[model samples]
Target: MASPSNYSSAPVSEFLLICFPNYQSWQHWLYLPLSLLFLLAMGANATLLITIRLEASLHEPMYYLLSILSLLDMVLCLTVIPKVLAIFWFDLRAISFFACFLQMYIMDCFLPMESCTFMIMAYDRYVAICHPLRYPSIITNQFVAKTSVFIVIRNAFLPAPIPILSVWLCYCGKNVIENCICANLSVSRLSCDNFTLNRIYQFVAGWTLLGSDFVLIFISYIFILRAVLKFKAERAAVKALSTCGSHFILILFFSTILLVVVLTNVARKKVPMDILILLNVLHHLIPPASNPIVYGVRTKEIKQGIQKLLRRGM
Candidate 1:
């Protein structure tokens, strides 16, 4: 319905990320805490990866899957946090057009990849608990390798169209993104052209990818819970539950924050824009920071691995 003449002929070369304009006066105070969170996420995941790599006793399918998760978390933190800290600390918020799309693409791919990894980890636990005998064969190193490949291909290739589609949309002058990072929706909405298709694809792709993973994870946990309940020995049941406790906590926090962000956005009238933006930013940080700590504290092998690494370092 809008005429082509109404839109500017010049292309948008860059975008300004307006990170929480409502709190501009005091936003610099966020620098210390956000920098700390970023460091914690990077350090924790790095330590977990190192501990797993150095501990040969941990060279199993479960720990391999955990290593994959740690890698994803670290990559995700690295991709999003540094730019965010730049915005908070030095007021550097300009992102080139290509870089913005690249960030959007990476976030699109990695967020769902992380979800898929969690689902695979859930499946690993389900097999370990429900069919311990078959776990050795069913969840072999080969299985992890295959699943890792599948996760990479499925997540990376399927979401490739999101940013591509966004690129086709004409941005006729408005180049300000309201969020900290180049989130898909935040960046897409800036286009002067009609972006309904972009919105539709993003919604469909996101729900189809993340929604199905969540469902499969839920089913896996249900089976795990059923299997744990059936164990005749109380100690066996407790051990089984303990094995899943950390994973359960991690997924719970991840899904809960994601769900809250989605709900707040859907009901944006009631939620303040600053709060919504804060939630989106924290969602990226909190999970990565907590994941390694939860697993290290709850899983004896990882705890011991970390301890061994610490002792060797000291």
Candidate 2:
């Protein structure tokens, strides 16, 4: 007979399994690479934020936005990676209700905020390229600060209803979450109740905010490309494109990976699911690591400022 301690007599509240199955063996080597990547990403993004804030020379609109982006990326990483690493390290499968809710909310907050920030950055580029003469007047420091505040407030409150509503939904049935993380999709799928409204909200948010943001981003880049082509000097065109190159690359990479994951998951691709999920973790972590380095490499102002900071330290 099994001991009472060994069995969950509480009707087995929930069974969350992140691993694929018994036949699929776990890879220990994957953890080493992942940990290295996580540390490097966190370090690079943090360094970028510090370098920009500490260096007086980086006090420009572009670098200011870059600093904000780095901060957001850090938030993004914190929301997902730490819990993931913990789960891997300790082989923990279950999370408390409050902890799960907090994780969901934080992830929700960062996702929308990051998208909004990118849209704002697009507007910044639009102003700089489209109306250089009025750029200063249009995108005033006050306006940027206000917009940043709005980004936080908008996401912080808007996503509150989502997790709250979901948590309250009936889960009296089997509570086995098949994903690596406590994803909204998996949670909603677990519920025995009608999740039509939840699906509607997900679709609307994905298509409207996320989808529209991407569209607007492309439009801004289109105009930017036009502006670049019109530049009389070769150097001017190269410089203008270079200013946006790193960000555009990162955006494209992330968007492509995200879209692939969504489609594959929706289609129920079993074999690639875990691998894609792992890649999603990398996708979240890589931006922070690469963002700062991209700016540091591309922008003279940031480069000079970082150099100055290092000199002072030495």
Candidate 3:
């Protein structure tokens, strides 16, 4: 038999990923709760989507945009959760090349799309609250449909180049990703080949899309604030603000999580990598999990609709 030292020193395969630093100490304590959250998020998000689609009361532009947001959250949860649960429950951490790429692709794609949706929702609020008289004409059904189509087209096309450029850069032979799931940065960092262009592309793409969307959202809200100030009634302004509150909170949380991960990940030291990774996963997973319930349970109309649906079903 081979010596114990020799066996202990065996080289790890390039693609055999052991994500956690203390893999041996890994337990399934978080798995059950995470799995439950995953199901809850998916169900709530999907139910919201179905509610908006089926309800004639929710046929307006605001509701249409909300429906789209619900769908985006549902997609985001679906893309990340199954793999996460699988990794925890079954110890199935190794993902193939194509699957990893696809996961990363979906993540990058949806993130920006969701940002766009938030921006559009901001504009909707601007029209509704800031320009109530003109809102009906400006946010017409046809225009809303067109905006929805534009969001879809932009989302599908925008992140296409990131994946292509990413895959083209040589990953050396070392394919072990450090995170629980394949992220663009984690995957790119494994490459032994020249990735200056790849890194530049990722930074530029991330900053450009994320920055632009955030700026637009801020600007829209600025005008909204000015308009709300003009309203003499304090309750009127509060009501208007409440309409956009959940989306704004969700956007702030998501963007902050993203900025923290992106800024920390590329730092010279690797000390913060594990923490950053955990935060990154939590950001992506939790919003999708909590958003629907947050918006649904908190909003009286949605709560009533859900109650009605459940009652009718029974």
Candidate closest to the true structure, highest lDDT: 1
lDDT of 2: 0.73
CA lDDT for candidate 1: 0.89
* Candidate 3 local lDDT, 1-314, one digit each (tens): 22112121332233433445454356356688778878878888888887777666767777777777778887777787787777777877767778777888888888888888888888887888888899899998888789888877877776777777768866645656777777776777777667677677777877777788889999999998998899899999899899888777877777777777767776729645567666666766777877777778667777777777778789
lDDT of each: 0.89, 0.73, 0.75
Q: Tell me how far the alpha carbon of residue 296 in candidate 1 is from the true structure, in angstroms, after superposition.
A: 0.6
Candidate 1, residues 1-314: lDDT per residue as tens digits?
22113234588888888778588778778889999998999999999999999999999998998899889888888888899999877788888999999988988999999999999999989988998898888999899999999999999999999999999988887787888988878888878788888889988999999999999999999999888888899999998998889999999999999999889988989999889989988988999999999999889999999999999999
Candidate 2 residues 1-314, lDDT tens each? 22113233244355463633332346434567777878888888877888888987777777777778888888878877776676567766666656665777777677777778888888888888778899889887787798889888987887666777678777765555555566676677767688778767766765666787788899999999999999999998887887778778767766776687677667765646666566667767777777778777877777888888789889
Q: Could you give me the TM-score of model 3 versus the true structure?
A: 0.89
TM-score (C-alpha, index-matched) for candidate 2: 0.89
Best by TM-score: 1
Report the alpha-carbon TM-score of model 1 versus the true structure: 0.95
Clash-forming residue pairs, model 3: none
The alpha-carbon deviation from the true structure for residue 208 of candidate 1, after best TM-score superposition, in angstroms, is 0.6
Worst 10-residue stretch by lDDT in candidate 1? 1-10
For residue 218, model 3's alpha carbon misses the true position, in angstroms, by 0.4
Clashing pairs in 2: none
